[model samples]
Target: MNTLLIFIGCGLVTYFSRASFILFGDRVKLPETVQRSLAYVAPATFAAIMVPAVLGDDGLANLVPPSPQVGAIVIAGFAIAKTRNMAVALGAGMISLWLLQWVGL
Candidate 1:
């Protein structure tokens, strides 16, 4: 019962916080520069979350060893750069990762 109540409380909080944006965004009238900067927020947030997970505490030094994950990321990055398609990038990354792992890298 306590866990159920806690979950309900958390859900309400999350919903209200997100709903507030939709409900009040137009009234807020943020500056043009701020609005423009908001476009980068998602990518910046994604990088912030992913970079630490990918690089770990050692950061770039972790890449010194041949890692399947790093190799897959590089392959995916190249695919995205060349093809500019997310599906292609994902396919390239997954396939490369599988191949690398199969080769016991």
Candidate 2:
């Protein structure tokens, strides 16, 4: 079927992309520029993912949540800047989101 073919194609592509590293990781010596560029891939990927989750409704679909998504981001940002701890920031952000949702804020 078309769906099964699509799945197989995507899986093969992902597998090869990852397997290249496992197979030839030590053999490859990338340039400094390439290495530096690769560092941004993580934040770029995070933004790519988070942008959709954050703006999915209000920015595009015109259906905004009560108030807490934006607030949660702000709180988490501050938490990271202040504490520099991912666990603490994530906990604070989740708790804030829950409270905001419960209070309809």
Candidate 3:
């Protein structure tokens, strides 16, 4: 009924929005200006998420676990940069955070 129709409508919209890209990937080209802007998307997106987390009241650092979170994230970033292994980086980072918090450091 109403619920089912709502689901169907949402699904159709989602499908079209996604499919529209594939359906016309090569048919349309973005201008050079737009292309350059698109290149900033990843850094912008990362900052959008990380900036708020790292900075809090008075723009002070809000380390993970409120103390060693910064250290953990640094370790994680380093691991990711050096090894390029996501799971290892995340696992090490999270473990470091927990260990620091657990030890009451």
Best by TM-score: 1
lDDT of 2 by residue, 1-105 (tens): 699999999999999999997887889998899989998999899889986786655575423443677778778889999999999999989999899888877
Residue 13, candidate 1: Cα error in Å is 2.2
What's the distance in Å from true for residue 84, model 1? 2.9
Q: 1-105, model 3: which lDDT tens digit per residue?
A: 699999999999999998986887788887899989988989899979986675656355454335677667788899999999999998989999898778876
**Winning candidate number (lDDT):** 1
Q: Candidate 3: lDDT of 98?
A: 91
lDDT of each: 0.88, 0.83, 0.81
Candidate 3 deviant stretches above 4 angstroms:
1-17, 53-66
Candidate 2 stretches with Cα past 4 Å from truth are 2-8, 25-27, 60-66
- Please list all clashing residue pairs in model 3, or write none if there are none: 64-69
Please report, as a residue range, the 10-residue window in candidate 2 with the lowest summed lDDT. Answer: 57-66
Scored against the true structure, residue 26 in model 1 reaches a CA lDDT of 77
TM-score of each: 0.80, 0.70, 0.67
**Backbone clashes in model 1, listed as residue pairs:** none
Judge candidate 2 against the unseen true structure and give its global Cα lDDT, from 0 to 1.
0.83
